[model samples]
Target: MGEKLKLYGFNNLTKALSFNIYDVCYAKTAREQKDYIAYIDEQYNSERLTNILTTLTDMIGAKVLNIARQDYDPQGASVTILIAEGSMLPAGETQLAHLDKSHVTVHTYPEYHPETCLATFRVDIDVATCGEITPLSTLDYLIRSFDSDIITMDYRVRGFTRDMNGRKLFLDHKVNSIQDYIEPELLRRYDAVDINVYDANIFHTKMMLKEVDLQNYLFKTDVYELPPKTRLEIMNNLRREMIEIFSGRNIY
Candidate 1:
């Protein structure tokens, strides 16, 4: 690593990472859609989300001071964890899993098309921290944590910190693109795009699966279950949905 920056005082720059991960699955029938929704809800319940956030805090060398999680009545969960730069709690001492300066939060949304049984599972996560630790440190782990078919990430550094000579530094680390933080092996599986504003200290990266396997996008249905023409139609629909989501617009 390069020599650490000589800051006159505490590094006050804040780095925030926000992510929207989408999992698109096609359910051939009404019952299949319902089952898929239930499955996603159960699989990503509050307890599981809490555990994931806890692990993220640990991976970034942060301590959790407080944790508040709730399971929605219908079909969703939300977990918010406050973290700080320090050691974890004692093994038996259970308390909030966050500190004042940092926090991690995740919320899930499961919905299906009213007409077609096209189901989508979306997870929104935000990690913001002040001081030396960066939210970028957990990017890859977060991506692999969920069933991500398309992903959009926004990373921004705010405010300024002072160096030894009282010079203001907007960014402490070097980052030309958010892709700089993603592992090349993981990147190879997706077609990625970068829209960065270098002068403003902001970076955005969007990724969509380069190749879609019909079987992977089908929930509670086998490839052989559908006739060749029908399978192709459903495949096209799923791909269209993913594209719309990735582009944040309706093209179909």
Candidate 2:
């Protein structure tokens, strides 16, 4: 029978231990007072802990594991080790069982208009299950349903500004996203555009709003407001509906 083992915390460290089964223990520098490695050792038995850590590392496909003492630890340095006995677990089948909650505070820039309180909030969604859909795909669906115009927007990939004929010009273009495009363009107009895009793994979402310089008498304004609780509730409902739609399909 396959052994059922569980290990908690220790981000990439868990994966490293699984691959280097020979390494009995390892240490991770603590960010604050929370020593993750020490915590794991305190929680589980030595043998079971070793098995679980090894399994998790194998499942995640790690290369070499390292041990480091936290620089800010008041109690001094501590090392963690693990031992492996069997083959590693499959990486693909692993699912995120839980997610820690985090919050982002919005601050207005000096140029921001005080009449309109604009705030940018970002929340990360951890994948708890492995299926046909990925986190990025899910985020795309959410963004598309939320705002379609966001997908196609002109942006400045790169370039420099010069005072040509007392006019500020920016060389820009309509690109898919940040990483995918890199070019330059010159513009004689000033406009503010707000954009939101997902990162590579859909692990993080980046939102940007900046004013472009132009020499035209006409001015354009773009504003983005944080969604209210009601809108957020609706979004949650929509996500649930989408999940139900995909779950109902029969692959066989």
Candidate 3:
């Protein structure tokens, strides 16, 4: 745990956490792919996403000032919530103007490849705050909120705040790596990597599930129904898809 720094005034350091979570599935037919996408759209619609963000806002000890959410046509959804420190604001003070600067947002992307029969649903979330409250506390809850197969996260602290003696403090807390904040049990379930710039106060972590249960990745398809050879092929294809996404490139 890092010691709390006694700041000269309100801590203006902006700490932001950005996350990308992916859920992959194998949909054998066109209908299955369409259905998979539709299912994701409904499962994570604006209403649901707003709930998640609001919960996250509470976890970080912030108050939601306003919310803007929309469910897109065909597929996808987006939710944005403006937040402020838990303290009550002065009379006639409006927090709406800070919507663009300090807020929690989430957007979903659900798509599939017709030829490959691989469907992927991606959720991008961002939490930015400019005060004593930090978004790091909500990491565990956010990770467990979705069926994440691969996850990439970036956390950075920007700007500077003054100490009692007027010395500048770039980061109020210590962060060796983003992985340090994740639960050890959760870390054991996945292979994780880190790319951090300590001087710049930037941290990045990417994770991919190490174990694959065939039935879990199949959409409306029974694992036992497929022949042994077919099962092996499906498993390989799924693994390949996960690898491609984890590496952020086409395997070939």
Q: For each candidate in turn, give its C-alpha RMSD to the true structure in angstroms.
A: 3.2, 23.9, 2.2
**Better model by lDDT, 2 or 3?**
3
* Per-residue accuracy of model 3 over 130-197 as CA lDDT, tens digit each: 87878888878888999599999999999999999999989888789888888888888899999999
Query: Deviation in angstroms for 241 in model 2?
Result: 33
**Which lDDT value does model 2 have at 197?**
36
User: How well does candidate 3 score on lDDT at residue 198?
Assistant: 90
Per-residue alpha-carbon lDDT of model 1 for 135-225, expressed as tens digits?
7878789889984999999999999999988889999999999898888999888889999999999999999998888999888778998
User: Any runs in candidate 1 off by more than 4 Å, and if so which?
Assistant: 87-100
Cα TM-score per model: 0.93, 0.17, 0.94
CA lDDT of 14 in candidate 3? Answer: 94
Residue 20, candidate 2: how far off, in angstroms? 34
Q: Where does the lowest 10-residue lDDT sum fall in candidate 3?
A: 91-100
Score candidate 1 by lDDT. Answer: 0.88
RMSD versus native structure for model 2: 23.9
